[model samples]
Target: MSDPTATGPAVPPLDADVIVVGGGPVGATTALKLARGGMRVIVLEQREATGLEERATTFHPPTLEMLDDLGLAEPLIERGVRADSYQFRDAKLGKIVDLRFDILSGDTRFPFRLQCEQSVMTRMAIAALDEEPLAEYHPNSRVGTIRRIDGHVEVDVQSGPRRGTIRAAHLVGADGMRSTVREQLGIGFHGHTYPERFLVISTQVPLQEELPDIAYVNYIADPVDWHVLMRNPSGWRILFPAPPSWGSDEDVLAPDNVLRQFRRVLPDRDADAIDWVTLYEVHRKVADRLRDGSTYLVGDAAHVNNPMGGMGMNSGVHDGYLLAEILLRGHAGEEVDADLDRWAERRRAVALDFVGKETEGNWSALRDDDEQRRAAQRAAWEALGADDEARHEFLLTSSMLSSLRG
Candidate 1:
């Protein structure tokens, strides 16, 4: 283990109060929060440029509330679609339950899912960071080694031909799942990968015109073919499970195969309507710990669940927000050891217990082949939807308000 307790030379001049090792949504959130809190912050990102890919399109209600607090929600909502309700559907029988976010009106201010690409949030955050004098945003900067010295953290960064060292009071690892900080710190990420890869097809097709009575988001369950369909500002996105039997990547991404999946939703679906396709593996992994000495992990570096309930990115944003709050309190000399401990414990617990199980349950419920279980699942959704109180409670949990509250 890289021990922060190891005796070292005196602390050197600090580059910033906190050094954030990624410039994505989570790192931007952490850096912006700290900079706004009157701490000098630096964000290092290795990407040369941002892509137009539609990654992580669903933002739950509580996540928007948190972003609103950071002054980032409104612009994103303006550029995105608002989904007031989502449906649990059966391929053969049709919609089983239409769960509306309006049921969470009393529980949260933003009682709807914001269907915006994550790039929008990151761009807005980076723009905000650029305006803040206390924050420095560095792109094309890759972080290497991490070392602890005299109660501070030091990191090696490589940007182009320049090699530099930055020392900070603390370091936050929000760099995606393949995080350099986590690897350098020797932290273990424990979990399993799903056998079937997930395939996402982005299309400009107005699916609402073709499908009857479809909401902005729909989870369609079928014994033979389970999939998720959602609408973004661009148009629509469909997710399908790609078993190994699907053949090679080129074969699965073939135009004919893409259209086959679309035709499963609607037989007359046009092949030319599809814009692009992506195939990637999914995993349910959580880091062994959120904090190791003065360095902390947030976002994908800390935990990653399947994007079933759209909880992966939302929960990661929550991590950055909560960690920043705790760190700010500690900086104020408020004796925040307990606060830090509580934050770490609670965040990890949420990842493993709440998000892990919720997403796994979603995937399982959608793909279960047994007729009895399908009937029971449908009845459960009906019972939950029929009762106002029960529906409200269910919406609270699904919208992530209950998770944040607890």
Candidate 2:
């Protein structure tokens, strides 16, 4: 609990209109947008500097559109692969249906997923932030405490070599799943963790070239173990489901065992050709509420989900847009409490109703041994491809344009 009256000795002045905790995609996006609107925004990132991350490689259509609007998408497009279609396949490598994004051309200017590493986007975001006179990104700054007083929020953080306090009219927590802000605020993140561990292996093997039947992104279903195979700038990534029974996370990352697992996808690729690999625990959770007074939660700070359909980071960036728009209106003297509340409510709704349900369904459809259920999954996927209207509708929804419109 923060003591409102206690500034504790001499305190630094309120530095900005808003203080954003976390400099990941969501926070960076939020700070960038707010700064663009002529608001003084300070972004606090715990990392000493931004580094390349192998995670969150897919940017859906709507997110790209938003970035384009901010003049940040063109460089991303130049650096990333444009995935025009996505597919689902059986264990034996038979296509179920190829959902083409081209069908969404009428609805969105960018009708494809941008397969760019999040590290690339983060660098671009920070660069854009550097250009904004109203914005300041303080790296190596982790939230110390957030207090509310005088109808305003004050954030204390350890930034680089200095500990300072910055006050603002509002604040945001976009740190991550294990957000310090969320924990200190005592928000309940309720959900279950999947029993299986997940691993993503980078490979030099040209999976797209070797497996001509597959699209750039392929979700292959199996009765027991499901996997996601996608193309990256490096080469390819095999997202595998590893149970603890297989071994510890370290054992799963062991080169020989990992190569053996790749046999399930690539029977001919040599072991030594492997690039690198990593593993993580998987969970599905949403905060009990995204808002606590004048502060808000967005991105992984608000929710965490399995990367089944590549929805986690996409939805978080969406939260940035949602929050930034409402806050901008409020700064203009508009009554935006309703809009801010709507942002929190609608984003939470999106986490459960869209990201959660869809991703859970994705895993269920892949590993369910029941033949009838498998057939239904295939049917639904094919329906997304074969029918023109249905295909357009599917892309619109899956690409998250519908989520925004909602």
Candidate 3:
């Protein structure tokens, strides 16, 4: 562990009202909200500001509305692909149905999914936080230990040459799944990991000519294999399951194996058609609780699920907003302890009941080999598209508006 008082000019004052760990999108959102509320906030991130990876590229409708409230939606929409409709298809049977987001026009001003890399949102939020006089952002900073003293939270951080203890009224862990803050707090992260891993391949090659009817987002279901094809500002991305039987990670990501996977989408394509590839395991874990006295958890620190319905990042954004809202209430002199308890319960329920179930159901339905279940799933999608009322309800849930409203 680095000393708490190492010297560097990058370090700000060793105190804040809120100290946020992990400067990803969720952490940035939390810091931005608290700073906007006039709280002294410090965001410490392990990585440099410009080095964020491209993850969680799909933004649901309510998420856009939330970004709009922060004056961030318009620029993102300008840079992203507005996916008005997304299709569910059978590999053998072709398109089953296309769920249109416009059905939610009456419910939200932005009625479409925005396909932009999550790094974009993080960068924007960090930039916005820069304008807030109360906000201090430190990149290349990794949080070490966290402890509570005298009803105040203290965080030990090492940022390049600087290492110091920062005292704060509260700490929010917006870090990723392997959150240092959460682990140090001894919070139980309970859930199971899927038997298979997910493989993502991004390509610069345009696929529209080959798949004329393909929407910006398409989930192609097969008894033996299911794949998700999506378009972001970068290019087209294809995601599919990689079972343990597929040998080691190196074997699964071999050039020949990767080309074989791409050939499934384009038979004529060669190795040159691919841009980059990655493999990650999916999980359905949720932290036992969101609060441990003055410390809190948000985003993947609180819950993680398969990225089937694109709910992971979007729901994480909602978590940041909700927690900040409740804390702001407390800052305004309201007795928010009861409200804090409610926040924990409400957020956990949203993670497990809404996000986990929906994403898992999606993954299950797409790859299910059972004829009866597949037929029922097909029928349900067909019916949803045939009736405006049913489509409205489905879109409400699909757009994640219903998740927040309830």
Candidate 4:
């Protein structure tokens, strides 16, 4: 599965045209796209073959189109819940503003959000790579050390008995927050952690059927109980701030408390309806640089943001797409490193100025309890709800398209 379009003088012979560490959605997408372009790619992942870790449910329009271009949109759409609209509301279900994807209909073929587990996209990407002979996927290959050599980069991967070193003209660090590539390259990942720990619980009670007022995606504001509730193929997922009374990590995730939280929403529901429960902390961050010589960072390794608007995964996939396009041009006799620098600068700015600020603002809008602040926020939301032009502009930023504007 060599890159059919990879022409011109080539990179020196090596293990691959690019070596990607982290076979999650971002890494896999980068590998698949590069391989399709006729370049050799190898994806190294620390987890087992194929990811089924249920997380990240919202896929924006641009991301859906990219998946379609790669032949995955139909399968994903068939398995996902199409959410044409989402809302901003109070904790008690009083809607403040409702945004319709129809505003973006002219900008994209799919003018809606898809609510499916991140695992769906990961598995599909892996299946696509399996058919690509030029792409190799190695699971349980935890990256150890990273070294930048004369004209290439060296990555040491450790697995059961296959512990060895891999050398490639370029390395992509989609490995995640504490990325080995970023650390060895001496890049700083500066960010702050939210004080309120987050908790996610699933239920089979059919959120939309029971709560007719709610959309497939809903964001509720509450000074003490800010939360997000959404419906997907998996079921109904409710993510909210953990209580201050939580004594220990184990205490908050206990089955009793988890059930208590769900029962609070629907006291009549039985145990069968409650499914999965998880708790984690949220962060907002960006790397010092996206590229350091022959090595480049994408996805979580490069940036992170709160899950308030489901921007993390979407932005990461966008990172992969932008980087792959730049690398493809570099192989065609363009200024390689210079192009990477440009990509890094632009993407990093998006992560900081666009994604970071947007997510933070979303959280602030929901969790702000001050009387004056809440009123001002409500006025803004009302304006967005009433004016078509303003709503369209806001949606552009919310959907991550404004980041591409000149």
Candidate 5:
């Protein structure tokens, strides 16, 4: 608990129309949007600088639209690789099924997925923030406490050696899974971690012989391990399901271990050229309530999904776009409480219906040891790929275009 009115030598008073906690993609985008809409906005980031992790690389159609609205799509495309199609292979059957994005050319400006590192996306977002004159960015600042006052919310922020208070008409928590703001507001995030972990490895490999011009390739129904290979700007990324008892978080997945696993699944490849490798535990969860009076939650603070469908980051960016619109309307004295609620409802529905379910399905299909189940999974893919309408629907769902409002 922090005293709202206590002004000391260490505590400074800061005021803004909106206070955004977290400097990740969602928070930065929200702050930029709010400030661009004529609101004085402040962004508090706990890290001194943005993280350069290879978290997400695929951006769906709706996300591209959002990026276009933010004037970032062009630059991103300039630095990204376009994935026009995805292939699903059955190792046991020795058969492959491919789905092309061009088939659904009527729905979106970007029918294809963009394969760019998340660090590149963050850089673009930060650049967009720099263009917003009304946005104040405070790096290395952590929000210690946030509370709703009579007409405004007060946030206690600690930046290195300095502690300060920011009073704002509204607040948004986009601080991700372990959201301090969400915890302070007593929001319940209900979810569970997956039984198996995922090992992600990136390297410069030419898949022209086996996978020519293919953007995304998934080796499904493998009894040993499930794998996904995608074309990155500079190289390729290989994602595989790790055994439940692989290693602890503190232990890093060494190059040798990564190569050994690659050899097991993809034996023909040379493993000496590995770039980076990591192990991540997958989780699926969402907060009970995304909003509490003047304070709201966005991004991973609201919901977290497995990366199988690559929906987590894209969904979070969409959260920023929708929440920004609601906040803008609210700031203009419009009735937006219902709209805010609608945003949460719609996003939560999509998360559960599409993101959560798809990831779970992917996990089940990949990890199932039964030969019958693997054959069933392969049959489903082939059947879906062979039918145009079925393939379109599947593409719409997988690309996240079906989840958008008309």
Candidate 6:
């Protein structure tokens, strides 16, 4: 909905304390936080609404703590399921290593992982923003151009029948992987795509009767068709790493193809219950810089990691939180240039050192057919299984609690 006052001729062509160029979770949360802090915020989304197609269903403990700070923990708990542990299986050894979330019990309020669709979180954030007077949501509004003049940032926007300019003290590009704002600012996103593609299928059948009470991330480390299966409220989400020679643009979501892959990876599941399937090419990329003057990039606009560890969405939300804090500090007459720099540096370190490495390693372990690679994986798991300290360290890393530290 357009703001009436903002549409009047008496009003300035563009006016806002901050302009967020993306209505995804990151941008929406940043705008909502700013509005809550009494700053006038405007968010522009190219999409008709904030309903995203891809699903990032796992929220780690640290991310849950950040959501709690935003007063969203209760609502999220109501709408999502909790995951207590992750099970890493080495089929060659017939050994399963259980990494529990209890290690973070003393460090954060949310010691367990939460499984909720990205769409659900977006809808919640949108509703929260709607109740804030200082926040205005502009869906179907695409940002065409951006310019930084003097001390203010200007943006050319097109929404339905209207085309206009928006000006703000600060601008944020939380758009996505192919961010228009990032392009406009000449920030380079550097990384390469994995040769292998990933196919994700969602099914309604109950695949956890053996461990019904515990929600664990299952990593099947088979060289032929390594996969991950996660439990959701409605169904189980299955992820398969396809061979490098798989089809590129063709529809891989067909039931036959999905069933074939499912049978190949997880032979135990019932194929008749498959509901939805999607195939995506995985890319590991990060922006060269997070900020340029009054404009900053957050979420996928800044970095995109493989979804193996479910860190992509979690890291994006964390970016929003960090940016919101810095912006609020700046608004309160604090010299936050150093704070902003630290935010970017620390985030990039975590993304590169933890998320990037873990996801890439998971991909390699899944795809490697060499006997040496299999033996190494077996040895690593054996060591991890024998030592509780090692198991906890692995859990902390997978749960993203380890990366929460500065």
Alpha-carbon runs more than 4 Å astray in model 5: 1-14, 160-162, 210-214, 247-255, 265-271
Q: What TM-score against the true fold does each predicted structure earn? A: 0.96, 0.94, 0.95, 0.94, 0.91, 0.91
Q: C-alpha displacement of 235 in model 5, angstroms? A: 1.2
Candidate 1 vs candidate 5: which has greater lDDT? 1
Going through the candidates in the order shown, the clash numbers are: 0, 0, 1, 5, 0, 0
Runs off by more than 4 Å, candidate 6 = 1-14, 92-95, 160-162, 210-215, 265-272
Tens-place lDDT digits, model 5, residues 95-157? 467788987789899999898887787777877787788888888899998877666899888
Cα lDDT of model 6 overall? 0.81
* lDDT over C-alpha atoms for residue 215 of model 5: 44
Candidate 2's residue-wise lDDT over 1-406, tens digit each?
A: 5567886665445678888899998899889999999889989999987766568999998899888877889999999988999998988648898888888888889999889888888889999999999999989888888788877888777667436777888899999999888888898999998889888878878887777888989899988767899887778889988987887877888878898888777888778777777788899999998988789999999999999888999999999877998899889899988888888899999999999988887888888889898888888888877799988877777788888884
User: Which residue pairs in model 5 clash with each other?
Assistant: none
Clashing pairs in 1: none
Q: Write the per-residue lDDT of candidate 3 for residues 206-280, one digit (tens) a residue.
A: 886788889999999988778999998889999979999999999999999988988888889898889889899
The alpha-carbon RMSD values of the candidates against the true structure, listed in the order shown, are: 3.8, 3.7, 4.9, 4.5, 4.2, 4.5
Model 6 alpha-carbon miss at residue 329, Å: 0.9
Tell me the TM-score of model 1.
Answer: 0.96
lDDT of each: 0.89, 0.86, 0.89, 0.85, 0.81, 0.81
Location of the lowest summed lDDT over 10 successive residues in candidate 6: 5-14
Q: How far off is model 3, as Cα RMSD?
A: 4.9
Error of 6 at 149 (Å): 1.2
Cα lDDT of candidate 5 equals 0.81
Candidate 2 global TM-score: 0.94
lDDT winner between 3 and 5, please give it.
Answer: 3
> What digit string (tens of lDDT, one per residue) describes model 6 on residues 387-406?
87887777778788778765
Which candidate tops TM-score?
Answer: 1
